[model samples]
Target chain A: MSRHVIGVLVENQPGVLNRVSGLFSRRGFNIDSISVGVTERSDVSRMTLTLDGDEKVLEQLTKHLNKLPDVIKVTHLDAGCVERGLALVKVDVSSPESRSEVMQVADVFRGAVIDVSRDTVTVEVTGTEDKIQAMLDLLREHGIKEVARTGVAAMARGPKYTGTE
Target chain B: MRNGCDVVLESFDAEGVDTVFGYPGGAIINLYDTLYDADLNHVLTRHEQAAAHAADGYARATGEVGVCLSTSGPGATNLVTGIATAHMDSVPILAVTGQVPTGMIGNDAFQEADVTGITMPITKHNYLVQDADELPGVMREAFFLANTGRPGPVVVDLPKDVQTAETDVEYPSVDDVKRGIRGYSPTYGGHPRQVKRAAEAISGADRPVVYAGGGVIASGASRELRRLAEITGAPVTTTLMGLGAFDERDPLSLGMLGMHGTKAANYAVTESDLLIAVGARFDDRVTGKLDAFAPNATVIHIDVDPAEISKNVEAHVPIVGDAGDVLGELNSTLEEMAVRDGSEWREKVKRWKREYPLDYEESDDVIKPQSVVEAINQHSPEDTVIATEVGQCQMWAAQFFDYTKPRSLVSSGGLGTMGYGFPAAIGAQVGRPGATVWDVAGDGSLQMNIQELATVALNDIPVKVAILNNGYLGMVRQWQELFFGERYSSTDLDQVPDFARVAESYGVKGVTVERPSEVEDAVREALEHDGPVVLDFRVAREENVFPMVPAGAAINEILEG
Candidate 1:
């Protein structure tokens, strides 16, 4: 099965997220990751969902998402789309050598050390999913404590917008 | 200035909703009180589920948005099955439910439930009116959403405070409400290119079959479907929900196609070179063993719901539009094309129909359920509304009846709810007061909502109920007997009440028919009754619906018993 990222524009109303997510679970479609936020229009919300399915599955998923009254439009963010994900990773750095190693690894990835404690260091990273995965892999050698990720947020690379008229 | 309840009534009036089916409870007392003196006709069903089913039946019969109302918590939850049934069949129904006050919504107040959360997946859309000002808009939107596009059930959960809270906001006009919903715009006309492609496919095929479904009825496309069939000389096979979409007496009609569908229809579909599916989804029941279904055919699917296209079975030419509009386009396009002569294919289908005619063994000792359906058909008018409870009785009604018009057969096709028929028949009778409405039910299915007999008796609804009393859940029993070596588990109804006596107890006319000879007379007597009547026919317990596909088997692999 191929991975697909679909961007949906929906009415910014109460329980609209529940309606969208409920449809996924009800129809037995699996969702890998989903990120939601208000768009340029305050009354509308944009949801970027990463799902694993084939062409037929993606088509079915998009059609079902469009059926929801809250959803305005659904777009498949394919080749010409820019996708990024934000992740916060806290690493165990009890020793000064380990702390410097973590700092160097974070510096190489262009990530910032957002918080530091006596035995732990939290790094804030924003990049493509692959880049974040690569940085996280390097930090894993230093004993990672926790990781919180805001799943991929995507948009078309060109001037054409998702919900634009 | 007006209260939220007044806005609700005004919205109904504006939408031309004359009837509502509901059950009263504490949370909805305010609305019920308002309905007490309103111009709207309110049908008080004995149970909330029956109310929903009746509304659904009304919607199916009249092509209008059926409305059902209920109180909070248990009352609202009771409407769940009916709502899901409507959702599955794409029936246009509006379910209005009362909620606990906004302040007590999350505190576990008495008679409180998350109505919106409960119905999220089952409804086309739903709303929890938190403010009084939102009531008018929500009511209008709920009706519009329920009735438009690929229609289904929509819920409006009104808080007690919202119902009582007053606001002077003017209720929006119908056009305004229709334009206000930005996210919901249903495609009405098929793409011209797709329609042309469909027409070309139809014209080029040597053997073609038109598979119709509930969408044809929903879009009022029966005439268009007939025109297309006549123009192309394609044999038409309908799903259970599409029973009345085309006149069954037509020479080209193949009746139904599916698990319990006719041999002729199944064979036609399996052998056809082109399958034109109009407003019908490739449901598991219809397309048994999906990979093996219509394998040789190039499918052209036209449906209002884009999601339904290529859902179960992939379509070669997918047209998204209302059934009537798409069929009209196809017919026009076909007029300009040289359609292939299908006389040889028609003769082949006719030979199949003759070779595998639907018939049941005649026994003077006991009643055959098929004969009961025939007896009803013989006595009823052409436009009679026949609703059936699920199981063998439902299949028998589908197979035996000669439906001549749309909106005549109102059976639960998608959800297959057992207790759907009686209440739905009541709703159909209410919708068409001058038509003869009959509920053909199995013993187990009829008992599920037999309580609705009180509602019918009270309202003096002249709905005739024919019970095929087999003393068991016959469909499951048939399965057990065939597939499980006669190990009849919990399928038998050991102590089914005498349905006729039960009807009599409800102050309605009742009759019990034991032998085959008594079927016609009982049906006539029931039909003659000016008010509601229940006729219980003790059908042979071991009889099973044949020409069966045995569930997962291909439709062509039918067993004729």
Candidate 2:
């Protein structure tokens, strides 16, 4: 099985997401992550879904999605597409030495310190999955207290604008 | 004033909706009022649910979109189960429900039950008209969606005011209607590469089995399916909904596959190297113990609905298109490809068919449900339409009836809803005037919508009901007896209603068959009836539908009793 990311443009309407999700679950699709947001056009919404399945399974899922009344278009995002995620992690800074080390690690990853307290430092990291994971691993040594992640949103990379056609 | 009701008439006229099965109620009085003067034929049913089912039967029988109407609240809620039944079977039906005045929506207005929300999941598309102006467009889209690609039921919830308020009734032309609805286009022709791949797989395999489903009939692909099977010389099997899609008399016919399926069909599936699934979803009942189902076969699924292609069985070569169109391409591709000799495979399938022919015990006192259905099959004219309710009777009918034509056998295959057959028979009879229609039902299921008898009688629709009155919910009873050690918990009917007498009271002909000898005569009498007729056969109460693969058991590991 291979991972496939599909970007769908659907007419902005209530319950379209539920319909899309229900279609996936009905076919036993294993969706790793799904992100939905309003696109450049307000009348249409974009849903970027990452699912793991063979070529046949992905093809069927794509067809089913297209059958939805609310769906306008579906694009199978290429493998070389750009995918990014955002994460916020809080690390305990009980010791001065640990706090200094955490700051240095955050600087190297280009992560910004969003909040600072006597016992904790909240850092915001934005990048592809690997970059986010590397930042989290570094913060772990300083007793990472909490982590929140926004699932990956993806798009095809090209010279011309890919407006979900 | 040309009101929303005029919009309804104009829309139906433009869509070529000749008949609507429905009932009049408070919320939809305006629609009923205008319907009285409209150019369409309206059959007033006893209940809203029956109307929905009748519409489904109508669609199944005629291969055209069926229409049903109901008032809001209890009326709309009543249509839910019927809508779900149509959805499951992929029957194209348009249900127009009258909601409370727009202002009263969501306020729990008397008799209102969030009709739109309740029917959302069950429908292909639904609309609660926000403006009277949108009524025409919604109706047009409802018909288009319901009859398109994976044909299914669609709902249009019109408020009382919407139907009463004056509005311009401009029925959009077909092309104009197309532009308004986006994102729901269904592919008719499959990808050429996939079709060629499927053809190659079929040609390469010696033991290939062609399994088809209801989609074959819905897409009018049965003729193409027969040609494909003939060209490949592979054995063919159908799901219950797929009956009549293939000629049962053909040597290649394996009847049906799955739970309670024929021993031959089940064995063919297990032993086959290539399984060509046409227009069929791998339903649990049809694929007992999913993991072990067709374990040896490489599946090639062709269907209009992409979701169903890989929903149950993984399709090695999946084709998402209209069944007829896909099968047509497959047939053409196979014509050019190197054809393998499937003669050996054909001989083995014939042997399996001979070894385990469908049968039942002969009783002197109680009617064998199988014998009753078989007798009907014998006495009925060619091309008789048979609608069945859920339970043992449904299985018996499926096994015994020689369905030779598409749309000849209509039943609740996917949802397995009871009380479906009787109303569906009404719809079928209404759709094809002069055609004989039979509701092969179980006592438990017949009682669910027995009220439809009044509608049948009033219309003089000559549909007949053959009730396998086993005095218990036979299917569930059989399960309880086998799996639950015969606890019989709530499975037995304390006092069975005299369904025949009930039908007589509704001004329809009624017959009761208690002795096994009377099965043939009773079926004949019912068939000859001028109006609706009900034949209540006091069948063997303890009868079981067999070749059953006990739930969760492998398809090949069946109890062939």
Candidate 3:
């Protein structure tokens, strides 16, 4: 019943993402959030997925994920891992006071004001999920008009990725 | 200049493919015409779906990449079930579908379907050829990917125009084609440390059992598996897909395990301390009551695919390599180690075998399904390749037959697809020139793809189809009798058209064996026939495949007949 994030390095091929997600659903594993992006190796892509399940099922899921042809490696990136998420939030600012309040909150959260209009302000925030969620909750007080979120992408922490690390 | 369709024919020759199971249509007319000039042999199946199953049977029987082809739209879509069956069971096959034309691909023109889009999920890889020049590479890649690693189905969607379009590009050599898939190298040898761990587990265990599956056959590891088992003196229990991978007559054999599995096999698996699973996936059916499967075993899973190691049941020593290669290495390690006394475990399993042996009532009027299978086992050659359609017939064939050689038994283990046997038997007979191939089918299931009888007759394949005619979808009927208040719904087949008559209509020999006394004689007659023959054994309508775990029930909670 707890959320766990897993980073998977897979071949950069068409429908590899679908295979990963399809394996999840077919095995009755519940996915919370999923994100994928090109890694340093253009031939390979990294998939960060969040799922809620018991440890046994999660272990089984990892094994199933590893079974796909395009999948190269899978690692649970919860500890000693640099995890981040991005969100673009538009806040309704009818009045100048509310707009200033929104900017003040964004500044405190280290979120940049990416776009500004007469009626609304859009903020770009990126950080660990906790940071993004806390900033979004604060922005909600100013009347959130829209929100778009990318799932967490993760990698091992620090300078080394060798077996010793 | 040679057209793209001729390139397809040349590519088949380049891959050493001698036979193709396919159905021709408008989109593939050019490819069919090209076949007439080429030396490639084609077994024209009655339906596209039969072509797919036949191809699967060919793969299972010959251990070669099976090939099937169909035209656009309905023809391509018809291969969905068969393709999925091959995919789920990891049978290597190349399914070529003809597209409407490059110009009309997405236009929804006559007989146009998104062949690639539809097969994307099922295939190991798929290609919708946008250019005729890429056809050679795509075709080669399809075969390479289909047969490599955890072998499964691959699709090549050639648009009609692409087949007709002239191509000057020469066909790629096998080496060049193998190079097409750069990232698809499969590990044939396991990590040395893991192999040692597995060997140590095998030597130290008092109750060791070898759980073999189709991967053994896929890797051609049956000889290695038998040697490994003999070295450790462990009883071997094969999964349904693993039938014929080991000698069933040997004292070390525990027969098939899981739902409808032998009591001794299931008990051995449940009680064993060390379960060495070779190329077995621990499927839901095999691991009934998954949590309780091999409850006390320290599983050592050896498979070619790394992903399968701990997917279902956790393996203490997960060795990823070809089954034959892994076992070969393990055998070397075990040879240096001391053998343990397994007489206690062997004796206990022997007692179980004696206590609850697979038995059925000998009836004079109605032919027992088990008895029919036994007669087939008794009469058929040791190398006979038996293909079964789904239902009581499949379970009975798996249980009763004495499979002594690899690739001697082929059935739909994963998808449990019905109507698979006749076409599969046809394919097996074609793949293995003179070997006896039998389609052990039920009345209900045989009717699903019965049209393939024409293919058998036309090809003069000499395949023997032993239809266990129970007049019901026997497995479903068993369920209905057990749980659904005995209401015989659509399960009642009523034997319309009569399978024997249907066989005769196809210009093949057909016989109806109603009495138990006729069973052996009918089987003999079928075997003696120079061409294709069908034996419809009218079995007990109420007969059920026993030792069922009752769906979610644990393997230990099986109800023995």
| C-alpha RMSD values across all candidates | 1.0, 3.5, 2.8
Candidate 2, chain B, TM-score (2 decimals): 0.98
Badly placed stretches (over 4 Å) of model 2 are: A1-5, A21-36, A50-61, A76-78, A83-153
The best-first sequence of candidates by TM-score reads: 1, 3, 2
Fraction of true contacts retained by every candidate, in order, equals 0.77, 0.70, 0.13
Predicted candidate 3 versus true structure: per-residue lDDT over B1-561, tens digit per residue? 778898898789888999998999999999998888778889899999999999999999999999999999999999999999999899999998999888886788999988877787788878888889888888877887888788999999999999999888887776886555544668999899999998888889999999999999999999999998889889999999998889988989989999888999988999899999999999988888888998999999999887787877888999989999999999999999997989988899889988987888788887888998999889987668999999889999998999899999889999999998888888888899779899999888888998888888887889998888877888998999998999988988774567778889999898888899889989888888899998888788888788788887789898855
**Relative to the unseen true structure, what is the C-alpha lDDT of residue B449 in candidate 1, on a scale of 0 to 100?**
97
Query: What's the lDDT for residue B429 in model 2?
Result: 92
Candidate 3 chain B minimal-lDDT segment of 10 residues: B177-186
Candidate 2 docks at the CAPRI level of acceptable
TM-score of chain B of each: 0.99, 0.98, 0.98
Name the candidate, 1 or 3, with the larger lDDT value. 1
Worst 10 residues of 3 chain A by lDDT: A156-165
When sorted by DockQ, best at the front, the candidate numbers are 1, 2, 3
10 residues in a row with least lDDT, candidate 1 chain B: B173-182
Give DockQ: model 3: 0.30
Q: Candidate 2 lDDT (Cα, whole model)?
A: 0.88
Model 2 per-residue lDDT tens digits across residues B39-98: 789999998899999999999999999999998888999999999999999999999999
Considering the two chains of model 3, state its CAPRI-style docking category. acceptable
lDDT of 1 by residue, B1-561 (tens): 999889989988988899999998888999999999999999999999999999999999999999999999999999999999999999999998999999998999998989999999889999999999888888888888998899999999999889999998888777877667877889999999999999998999999999999999999999999999889999999999999899999989999999999999999999999999998999999999998899999999999999999989889999999999999999999999999999999999999999888998988998888999998989897669999999999999999999889999999989999999999999999999999999999999999999999999999999999999999999999999999999999998999998888999999888899989989988988888899999989999999998799889999998878
